[model samples]
Structure formats: structure tokens, C-alpha cells
Target: MKLTHWWPTALNPISNVAFLRPIDGGMKLAMLFQLAIAASAFSLHAIAAARPNIVLIYVDDLGFGDVSCNGAKAISTPNVDRLAARGLRFTDGHCTSATCTPSRYGMLTGEYPWRKKGTGVLPGDAGLIIEPGRATLASILQQSGYRTGVIGKWHLGLGDGTLNWNGKIAPGPLEIGFDECFLIPATGDRVPCVYVENHHVFGLDPNDPIQVDYKNPVGTEPTGREHPELLKMKLTHGHDFTIVNGISRIGYMSGGKSARWVDEDMADVITHRAVDFMERNQAQPFFLYFAYHDIHVPRVPHARFAGKSGMGPRGDAILEMDWCTGQVLDALERLQLTEKTLVIFTSDNGPVLDDGYVDDAVEKLGSHQPSGPYKGGKYSLYEGGTRVPFLVSWPGRIRAGESSALVCQIDFLASLGALTGTDLSQIKTAGDSQNVLPALLGESQIGRQELVEQGGGNQLALRSGNWKFLPAFAPKNAPAKARPLELFDLNQDPGETTNLASQYPERVNEMRQRLEQIQKNP
Candidate 1:
């Protein structure tokens, strides 16, 4: 038997006088016991060393086909491709929702955002959606002796309803278990265009108090609606409000001009900040949630990557995102943490061209399929909307390969909890997260047997094995078109072109009922 195991059994008779006496093999027994104790300590140290430093690279609005590894020829994601080459690349991975806010909420909380009201997209100055003491992904890891930090776009909202941008912001990432945080209060296209490091604005001047208003105009700045000449990028839709760095955002902002971040310099700024976090926490196991704000609305690449991609600003932004990924990977290598780190790359949702501004995303598109073989993109209840790029890499540990495992970001809570040896049974708030660590690490081909996909307007679809079902429902405030239930055998129709609702009525009914039950209970 192993010395570590045998030592514990032999330790039962420690108090016995006969066992302690230096007679016969008693001296040899003492030496063996000392050796066994040393062996046990070494075994424990090895186990602790095995717990890797996790770096989750969550990208925004990046499609499955945007990376070269996923079949994109227009733009190359060498850094993301490098990750796929080193570890398992999931072919059928997904986010919980089609939109950014809900998907992010689902990913962190491990609970379906649709089940909880007020989890939708928030304004620039909305309150904290996540309750302060709830069990979250970061909190779980934090409890497992991991130093947790988040840097980048934190659209999950901050503070209570009455948030003071100039003062300390409470009920934020710090309150929810993150030891460190450097975040954008909302999306880049939103107002209050400043960075929030921990609690206060990064470079806010006390004299220049910040004021933000979404309803009525607050600042005397030129808006996209009034001054079209001031805009460096033109708007195609409703992103016409106060101008902050030659671009009008969704809301109005008055002060904190010194703290305002330049749109072109955002990637560089955040990339450096992320590297610094890793450097500071390299001595121990750290969980860095590096969310990237790239290839999203107002696609403004830095001057270095301005015209790199011939496909315009959107493609250029993709290249920029790839560079950011490279920066993080290079940092890991520099810090000698490559093999000791577990990195996961994925997107919040699918991609959408012309989300708000017109940056030639559609015009310069020359035979580039953003969603690859999927049907829809962004806000629709189709395969393309929620299916995103999911790549995981842990050098020397996770074998390099491809997996068709049916996995979702919602499972990160339980899967990672299992990885860190946290007692998941004690975490009652992990609503729908399942421990899919084996699947995530490429040890198993199967993941979740069924997954729930959410699109815009709280529309949902169900996926069971190779079959997908979409229930019939009329959209709000729209003309009530006679829409029928839809079903597809995904193995045959991955693009979701054929609607087999008429032929398979019984299966549709069963799936619809199952979906309803999940919604009601989950």
C-alpha cells in the first residue's frame, strides 16, 4: 500500500506503550512512520501545486467564425488559434443568452438570467444587479484560496440606484468577492466614459464632479444628432447623445474630463492593466476574469492596428482583439506561469454587424461568414446567436485536441468549483451549473445532455442531444404573425433551415413541455 495511506492506519495505536517501546521492530517502525509523514507532506504539496491559476478571457461580440481556427479567412486570430493548438477547442460550446448583459449575468451567477427579472441590459448608471453576498464564480474561487481579479468591460452594472461616480462605489465587484477590479462602468458606446478602478473613477478630479443623465441632456457637449461634423465615426442608429472623444454615446455626461478614456487607446490601456494584475498575483493561484471590449459597437482600432485588416474597422478591431490576447499569453510566458495557468477564451454572444455605428462592417464584407454555418446572429433564437468560440488551454496538463462536447458558460461555476476542490454541495445558489470538469478538460465527449438558449426578448430554445426545439410565441408590440412551433435535428440541419414542426408534432409538444417545466422550476 502507499506510505501515505498506510501511515494513517498505523497512527491509530500511537498512545499504546508497547508500540512506542524500542523493542524488536519498534525503532524501524518509528523510522518508517517518519518517512511516511514526509511522503504525505510531499503529496499534499503536489496536490496544491496542481491547482492552476485560471485566466478566463471573455470577449464581447466575437462570432464563432471570426477566428481563423474557426474558419474565418478574412481575419486571423493567431493568439486564440495558439490557445486552440495547445488545448481542447469546443465545437458546440455556447453562452447562456444571445445578448451581452444576460449572457454575462448567466456566466457569473451560474443561473439563467431570464429566471431573474432586472437582469437585462443596464444603462450607464444602473445599480448593481448581483446581490452582494450571493455565491458567484469569483466568490467560489476566492474561497478556494485563489486571488481573484477582473479587468475590462464590466457591463454588469455598479453601486446601488444612486451611484456617485466621483465617490466610492459600493456593492460592486469588490463587494462580490473580487480582490481587485479595473473596469469600464458600461460599454464603450455608453456615457460616463471613464474607467472605474476598484471603487472610484481612475483619474477623476475632485473639482470636476461627474454628472450623467440618460433621459434628458445634461452636458453642453455636441451630440451626434445636432453636430454631425464633430463625429469621427457616423451613427447608423440610436447612439446619438452627448459626445465624448469625437463619438456620441447613449447618454449625457458633464464632468470628469480628465478621467475620460480615449476610444482608440482603450485596448492598450486595459491590456496593460490585465498584465499588471497577473504580474502582481503571480506568486499564488489567481483567477483573472479578463473581459475584452473588442469588435463591438463603435469599432475604433488604435493607430497601430487602424488599417491592418482590409475589411474595415470591424475587422481591424478583430485584429486588435487578437493582439490583446497575445499580450496576455506573452505575459504568462514572461512570468513563467504558462504551464501553471489555465486559460479559457470565449465570447459573451454571437456577432452583429452595424450594432450601432456604420464602420463598413457590411459594405466591406467580402465573402466572410461571421456566424460560419449557423443561421442567425446576435439577437435571434438561432444557432448562431448563442453558439460562440470556446477555447481552453492548460499547458502540459490538458491534452491538445478538439471536443464536440455540449457545454455552456453557465457550467463554469460548478466545473471550476470542482477543479478547485470546493465543496459544491454547500453552494445552494448554483442554480443550473453542473460540474462538467471532465468534459471541459477533454476527458469526456459528453457535457450537458440538454442546454437552454436565450435570445432577445426572453425568447428561448432547447437543445437535447442532436435535436433542437423552438416554442411558438408572439413577440411583444409586434404584429401577431401566426408563428408555429419549430424543431430540427441539429445533426442534419445545423443551420436550422428546415422547420419540422408539422411532421414531428409529438416531439415538439414533449420538448415544449420540458422547456416550460424548466422555466417554471429553474
Candidate 2:
């Protein structure tokens, strides 16, 4: 019946004879046609199976306007700019939450961080937040035959609550499906400041075992509050607990001296590890979540990048971050994996000038707006908090252009899950993560129809189209005032200055209902 199918098996001998004789031209043509069809099908299937290498460059505390491509005139992120120039730059891209822990949780697990307890910013010694056996981005990709590795800031907690630093750290990135992990278990500013490689602290001497305690001082380590003279970088607030590397941290540690990571050399060290990962795994498809440590608190750049940005440590850190990004880009190019890799550059949350360290961010700002034209920064329920710079580059696959599609980091699970042919329906806890792969590829202008934005605690806001609605909630530390429901069209008021809650009560009510629905269901 089907010439393409039957010709190969049944008429093979006859077709060959016909070709040999050069008489039965019709048979030769049919055979040729069948072969061409078979080859085309095989080629298509091969192309479909060849999944591209994925590199998620998750930056810490970077803002929307921090890169030059996104309107930062004061500072230039050339690597990030080159990425934008070659791929899709999303203007309305957002993370699930405005804070680090929640955003990372959402990114890895494909579930809202608010749904889980203890998803808040964890200390260095806190237990793993992601439950064991949970389906994660790394896990999903690993299932599809990709080598998953996470390098750099891993603020996601490690091990059980009674975690012994000297012993094997379980239930970490390895347990969560990552094959390889070299990480800062928590934030750079936090303590027990040692690099955790795979399961144990890197370079930890067994003779001088490591000990960590967040509640109390462990040994004779000088503290910033007690000994301000020892601090090279002065603390402005809560970071005056324990001194490590001449800088005060939030927690205390005694004897991980051999394993401690220098603040300035973090970028270089992590970049080397990441590039090494790429080089080693170049033969196979890999998922490398190379999170940057620069541009975070206690902004200590290498001597090369020192004073490069006039905006003090903050600006210098941005430059350092850009350099780190360039290194990865260079590695990808060197390995000839640029066209075969999908590199996504985005931040965990928004920006903050004076987040516990006195790095002169406020006084030396010099008219550089980190959060762009949006109101609020890291901790608020405004656009600036969640709406961050998002760039996705896949060389020839994703066309270079700007897209206003409202995408979120939370959706990566579903989007990539769909991309790699994973069954999203089987993923039990993919909360609020929709597959907008087409939008990510710059094929579609529309992204999520509605998205939920989270603040510090249980506070929430709904973003539908260009309109944003925040339910009535009183300010925490502000003066006594009844802050009513607020709504603003982002297209009209990008600064979020005017509250149109009174004008559109019905719309607010609808969005509020939608928010409640998502939260309750999720």
C-alpha cells in the first residue's frame, strides 16, 4: 500500500535489478523516493534527539538596569550585552519571589517557594529545603541523559538539621539530582565560609576538622562587633557576628581555616570550576547552573576590577560579574559548544545598595539606577524586586531580538521539561510553572497570562497583562496608616507611582481572586 514502507522490504531485489538494467525507470524513481523519505525521517529524529547543552548563569542580587543592554548607562555588562545582542532579551522577566532563597527554590523545584515552610533565606547550617526525591530541574534534565552540575552560590540548604560539617553532608545538591556540585552552601556574607565540593568541605584538613555554630561563637575568631579594627570591610548592621577573612559574617565558625574561601577570589575560583565542568562534559549534553557570587554583599572584587566602576564596591562587583560571565562565554566558544548550548543569564532577585555591608554603595552611587525605572528593590512587592534582567541565547536557534513577553524563572521547569520531552503531568509539584518555551525561543510574543509576585512574608501581588494589583496590607515598619489595595498599569506607570485601586475595583477583585486561587491550589 505505502510505497516508502513496502518498497524497502518486499521490492528490494526487483528495485536493484531495475536500477542495474536501467530500463524500469519508474521502479528506480520509486526506490529513490523511498530512500529519500527514510533519510529525511532519520535526520529529523536525530535532530530531535540531539538536545542542546543548557547553562543557566544565575547571578546574585543583580537588577534589571544593572546591564548596559537593559539601560544601565553608568555600568556596562559587555558579555551580557553580547548575549542579548545574539538572543532573546525579555523586558518583563521575573523570578518567583523577590528574595534569594525563595527564587532559587522556585527555579530548581518548579514549585512556588511560598508553598514550602522554611523556604526563607537560610543560614549556612540550615537543613535542605527541597525534600528528598522531589522532581527538580536538574533531576529532569539528568533523566534526559544530561550531566547536571551546579557551581557557585548554592544558598539552598544542605543536609539534615543536625548536619556535622566534619562528616559527609547528605541531602544536598547530589541528593537533589545534580551529579556534581561545588558550592558555597549559603550566602557569601554568611559563615562556615567554606567550599563544599560534592559532599565534604574542599581542602578541609582531617587533623584540624571544621566546626560551625550559628547561635554562638565557636573559637577565638574575632568578631566585627567586638573587634571592629580587624574588619577590612566594615559592617553596617546584622553582619557583625563572626569575623572570617577579615570580614564579619552572620554566623560563627572555628576551624575551617584550610577550607575557607577568600571573598575576592570567589569569582575566579567558581569560574574555573564551571569552565572545567564545561570542558570535561563537552562530549555529552550537560546542564550547568553556574551561579555567580559577585555583586552580592561584601562586594569584594579582584584587584584587576578594583575601582573599575566609579560606583564603589557595588559597581566593581558588577564589572567582576561581567568578567566572570565573559569567562564562561569564552569557555563555551573555546570548546566549540556555543551553537549547541542554551545559555540563560538572569538574577536571583533584584538589587540592594546597602544590604548589611558598608561598601559605600549609597554615597558613591553617582546616579546609577540599579533597579531601572521600577519602584522598590530586593524586598518589596514592586516590579523591581522580581522583574530582573533575563537573557536567553542559543546561537542560531534563538533569534537575536527583544521580547516583552512576561516570563518568569519559575516556569523554567515546565518550559525546559517540555523542551527535553519530559512529561510535566508526572511532576506532582510543578506549581505555577507553565511551559513558555516558544516565548523563550523568541517565537512567541506572549508569555504567562498572569503571574503571582511574592514579597518577604505571606504578602503577594498579581500581575495580569500590564496591570499589577497588590492587596491591602499595612506597612511593617512604616508609620500608622491604612494602606489600601493598590493597582497600577505597568505600561502607564513603570515607576509604580500612582495607585489606581479606587478606579478599577472590579478588576482588582478579579485579580485578587485569581491570586487566592493560585496560592490555595498551588
Candidate 3:
């Protein structure tokens, strides 16, 4: 009468119970109860296995019209197109902000970035912005038994205010919620041009320590401004500091020569690392935030992709990014994890040319429109600034279609929480996130009733239904002008050319009040 003797090895609890013979009625009752517990445990394990692995491929400066599926003729994104063909493509998807840092902040924290101070575009030497021990999206998933990791551009900063690059860097990705991270500390155009793997620089040498500064020059390295002949890529604006890999970056860095990354090989390196993470965690559900640094400034694409597009380095970088997406998709298919994994592809913000470098992105632009049919890009508070390509694929779970549901990246935390059946009540910081799992899964055609969009200088816009409201506000240090409130019925004027704020006074007042209420409450 040992229960172990009758325990099912293959979880055939009922079949195994047939072979059990009890010595007494009490023994029979105990054996049946134990068998039921074993069956229940097996069912729980099956449910856990059914939870889909999530991979969020966040790109940098990629526009709404960059992909072939979204009507781009100059560039071909076969991989991304394939994803859209097999999944849901969002026509009205957007990031929370026009800039990178704030959009990333809002997505991860599930709160409006403007509500918090110091969440603007950060310097290269900035400290970890997301406070440690806080409830982030990664932390929520991690608590729900998902292995979490972030690979590639982690512009969310690292360590405390006083960070020593040579020593162990704490309060980084590890402290926030991610179990592991391989990051490009800030942006590609910034310094400390080295990879940070978890707590230490990837390949640091003890002989040469690292020092980074944004205010002044730290090293005797020839800069783009000082030595123009040394540069492989010319500078157009402010990125004229310490040179690494023949290109000057935004900040100045002295040492860590051994760990400096080559811009051309970055896509390959990060893609391989992302594929490896998926392979290692194939047995259990995992969350991978594969943030790409491609299509950004200093657009030094690999030779394999060079001149492949007639649109120069910017177009070539788009192809390189597509290749990275293909690599991840291939890995999923090879591992037989495609059907069991949910993949989301999107950009941090809209596209921009001549950001900081002279990469022929403007001259060779030809007739291709990076932001598609929308007006304004990158820094403007227009449709093109925050609106970007968004695709979601979960194989058999999500049907292939297009949805114009008004979705924003800020809702990811609550949506994912709903998907994983996590208890969101315990996490009190997710004030701005809404659970739009049905919208995300193609079960619903409607999303957020109202969404806020932020642009350069913290300029805010409100989108309610088919109308967009842009309140007037002069930016810091700009010449004063009579800037009136602007409104557009997006269904009629997606370009936002017609300002109807005067025509509809009531609508303008209503949206203006709503925007103020969100700002005051949120």
C-alpha cells in the first residue's frame, strides 16, 4: 500500500489506479485522493506548457511605410511581410512618444513618460531611469513563470548615477526584472561604444579602463570635427566626439578599446545572440525583447546588404533589419516553436533622415516616403511622428488580417498580463496600461477609446476615435508666435492638413478638457 507503487509514470492516472489493490477501505480512499492530485498536477503542467513564448522585436527609427506589406516599393522587407501575411497588421498602431527613450519608458513602465521627470531623451552617461524593485512588464511576466531577457538596444540606462564602467554595474536590467541582458547601453550614436553583458562589459581588458563623458572630451581620439579625413562616415550635426570604428559618436569615451563594437557587424552579432537565447529556453516559455539598432544614424550596414537597395545606407540598413527578423523567425521554425510563440514587430518611433550623420539618406531618398502618406516625422506631433508599423503573430492563435484598431505600445503591460493570466492587481504602478488582449489577438476591432501621443519638447496630442486634437504650446527658447489649437478628422484628413479647430468649437473644448484631465490625473 504505498501510493508511489500505483503512481502513473506517463500521467495515466486512471489506468494506473486499475492496477492498485487496497488492503482496507481507508487505504483505497487515500490512494484515490493521491491519484486525483497527481492528475491535477499533470493538468497544471500542460496548461503552463500551452502558454506561448513571447518575442518583441522593437526596431529603431523604422517608419510606417518601411515594410513591403505596408506599401513600400523602394525597400523589400520579405521577412516582415511574411509575418504580416501570417498575422495581424495594425494600420493605426503607435508608440507613446515621438522619441526613443520616452516611448521605451512608457512601454515598459505602463505609465505616461511625461508624467515622470528625467524621462526625456537621455545622454549616453545617464543613470538607470527605471527604478529597481518596481513592477515593470518584465517583472510581471517573470513572476508568472516566464524566463525574461532583453537583447540589443537598452537605452533605458544602466546602474546608479555614479556608474563605474570597469567595475560591476548594478541596478541595471538585472535589478529591474530581466533575468539577463546583452545591451547597447544607450544608442548607436552614443558612447561608451561597448557592449554591456549583464554586470560587466562584454570583453573588457584590465589594462585599459573605460571613462565616458557627454559634456567634454575624455580621450585624445581623433574626432570627426578635428580630423575629417579619419572618418568613414561624415557628420551633419552634433555627433562629432570620440571616434570608434571610423565614426565619431555623440559622447566622448577614453578607454575600453578591446570592447568597442563594429557598426557593420552589430546586426549579425545581436541576431545570433537572440537566436541562441531562444534555443536555450525552448523547453519553457520565455520573453525576448530583441531591440534593433539598425536604420539609425551612422548607418553602416554590412557588405552583404550594401548597395543591395538603390536608396543607399538607410535602405541597406532596412534590409539588414529584415534579415535579423528572418533569423529569429527561422530559429522559431527550426525549433518547432513557431506555433507556440507570439511575435510582435514594431519600431520605437517614426522615421527620420539626417538625424546626425551624412549617410546619403537625404540625397538618395528619391521618391520613397519613409512615413508613407502621413505628414511630419521623428520630432513633429503629427501622425507620422508616433505612428509606426505594428504586427502581431501567434501562428494558429491569431488569424491573418489587418486591423485599424487604435492600439499603442503603452498598453503592452496590461495586455501581456491578461494573456499570461497574471494577477495585475498586485502591481500598482501600471496606471496607464489597459488590457487590450482581445484587440491584440484579433478578437476585437476596437482598442483604446483615447490615446495620448508625445513629441519633442514634451508636446502632447490627443486621439479620440477618428479625430486628433493638437493643443498649442510654444517650445522652450523658441520665438513667440500665435500658435492656435489644431484639430483633424483623421478619417477624412489622415495627412492632418485641414485644421478644423475653429469649425468645431465644442469638439475642441471637449478633447482639450480630456487631455488636461489625463495630464493632471495620469
Q: What is the C-alpha RMSD of each candidate to the true structure, in Å?
A: 9.5, 10.0, 11.5
Tens-digit lDDT string for candidate 2 (1-522): 322222221101101111112223356686776687676446434434768899999999999989999999988889889889999999999998999999999999888888888998888999999988999999999998999999999988999989998889988999988999999889999988899999999999888877788887788878889999988998788998888888999988888788999998999999999999999999999999999887899899999999989889999999999999899999999999999999999999999999998899999988789999888889878899999999999998888999999898988887787667665676778756777776788866867778889877767899989999998888678647335789999999999999998888899889889888888886
Encode model 3's per-residue lDDT on 1-522: one tens digit a residue.
Answer: 543334222111101112333343466777786887677446434434478899999999999988899999888999999999999999999999999999999999999899999999998778999999888889988988999999999888888878999999878999988999999999999998899999999999989999898888886887877888899988888888888999988988998999999999999999999999999999999999999999888899999999999898999999999999999999999999999999999999999999988888999999888999898888778999999999999889889999999898988888787677676766667788877666788966867778899988689999998999999876567647325689999999999999999999999999999999989985
lDDT of 3 at 509: 96
RMSD after Cα superposition, model 3: 11.5
Query: What TM-score does candidate 3 get on C-alpha atoms?
Result: 0.90
Return the number of clashes found in candidate 2.
Answer: 0
lDDT of residue 195 for candidate 3: 93
Clashing pairs in 2: none
lDDT tens digits, residue span 499-521, model 1: 99899889988999999998998
Q: What global local distance difference test value does model 1 have? A: 0.87
The order of the candidates by lDDT, greatest first, is: 3, 1, 2
Candidate 1's TM-score reads 0.90
